[model samples]
Each structure stands twice: as structure tokens, then as C-alpha cells.
Target: MQQLNVIGLDQQGAEKLGKKLNKLLASYQIFYMNVRGFHWNIRGERFFELHVKFEETYNDLLLKIDEIAERILTLGQQPQHTYSNYLDNSSVEEAANIHDGRECVESILNSYQSVIRLQREILSAAAEIEDEGTASLMGDYITEQEKTAWMLTSYLK
Candidate 1:
């Protein structure tokens, strides 16, 4: 069998980073599901425009979900994929039963902020444990979610 290629992570540090990574992954999954809901249910005076915009936004969030899931696996953890896991693990709420355009916007903006906060915590954990790779990953997530939340919040105003 090949020896492990991952470098410099002691057991405790790696485990800490893995836990942070799984939380981030779960948050990404929740954000992605919420975006998909808005993409399908967005109907208003800007029906066509918002529908198209939601599609693009949801697609972007979907890609981030994939990246975060794979990052968790790279850290040697299984990704949380089931609805049960999501409902239990996610602080973000489901976007169904929402009828108002501004409501969807508000919910999504909240999700964006939540993910960004998670990213910051992850980055801090990784740095505290001296895991450069996971820290870098969390930094990228922070930037992504911050920019997304800024855009969505602006639209919501």
C-alpha cells in the first residue's frame, strides 16, 4: 500500500480541520438548496429577469457545494448528503413556502452571510492548527460568499 501523501498534519490538528471542513460543507449544501428553490419559484414583475438571475446564482452555489464536499473528503471525512443530515445540521432554513420576491431575496442574503461567517470560523480554526491548505480553502470561500452576499444584499435593497 502507498503511504499517505498529505503533509504536516498531526492527528489532532487534522481532525480539527476535518470537523471545520464538514461544517463548512454542510453550510454550502444548505446555501445551494436554498438557491435552487429560489431559481424555481421566483415569480414577480421581474419574473423573467429574476428567474434567469436565480438560475445563474444557483448554478454558482452548486459548484461551490461540489468543491466543499470534495474538500471534506480530501480531509478524509464523508460528506453529509441526505435530507436528514441537512435538516439536522444546517442552521440555514428551507426556502419552500416562500411567496414574496423580497422574502426570497432576504432569505438568500441571510444564507450568504451565514456561509461567509462559517468560512471565517473555518479559516481561523485551520490557522490556529497550522493547516495552511485548509486555511487557504476557507479564505477562498470567505471571498466567494462575501462577494455573493454583497451582490444579493444590494439587489434586496
Candidate 2:
């Protein structure tokens, strides 16, 4: 017989989801730091605009990071808290010295692509196990990220 967690999700399936969420969490942490760098190091004529945008993006990423960590806790797993773990598990690259506005935007776009792809995978896995909480979380993230990606892409053109 399959055991269930406090939230009524199958213990085994929730563990799988927790592992996936840890990877996503790692990616967000790296992306958040990258955006922080972009926010601080950005230069050129568009500095003011890009700085504000980067700050907003990083702030939003921070919120998602907390939410993801809490979800992992809810799933009966501990969130990986070390930078080494984040570096080892993350799919998102840690961008550095990206001072140019266009370069920063491009980096952000690339990170979004990686994150959104992973989110879609999680969404599918969650659906397979009838985990609406995880599915809804991923769905909301993907939708918001898609819109942000479009806007960033438009800025590049």
C-alpha cells in the first residue's frame, strides 16, 4: 500500500516532486544572483531602465525561491541550502560581469528558457500523480515567465 503525506499526496510521488523542485530551486537561486549582478553592474545609456528592471526581476525570483522551498518542505523533503549544492544541481548558468544592457537581457532570456522548460516538465510530472498544488504552481510560473520573456525579447529587437 502507498503511504501518503500530511497533504494527502503519495509519499513516494511527493518525494519525486520534491527532488524536481529542489533542482528548480537551485536554478532560481543561481538566476537570482545573476540578476543581482546585472542589476549592480549594468552600464551604458540604458543603465537606469535596465537596473530597475533587473531589481524587479530579482525581487520576483526571490519570492519564487521562498515559495519553492516551502513547497519542498510541504512535500516532506528538506530544501538544499548550500551554494555548492545549487551550483551542482542548477541548470541555469551563473552569469558574471554582464555589464551591457543588451547582454543582460539576453542572459535573462536564456535563463528563462531553461527555467520554463524545467517547469513544464514538473507540471507534467505533477499532473501524472494528480498533484494539483505542484501543477498549479508550475502553471502560474510558466504563464508569468512567458509574458516576461516576450517583453524581454521585444526589448532586444
Q: On residues 34-128, what C-alpha lDDT tens digit does candidate 1 reach at each position?
A: 77777777777877877777788788878877887777676666777787777677767777877567888898888877777777888888787
In candidate 1 the C-alpha lDDT for residue 129 amounts to: 61
lDDT, candidate 2, 109-149, per-residue tens = 99999999999999999998889999999999999999999
- Sliding window of 10 residues with minimal summed lDDT for model 1: 1-10
Q: Model 2 — TM-score against the truth? A: 0.98
TM-score of each: 0.88, 0.98
Q: lDDT of all predictions, in order shown? A: 0.74, 0.96
Candidate 2: global Cα-lDDT?
A: 0.96
Q: Highest TM-score: which candidate?
A: 2
Clashing pairs for predicted structure model 2, backbone only: none
- Cα displacement (angstroms), candidate 1, residue 107, comes to 0.6
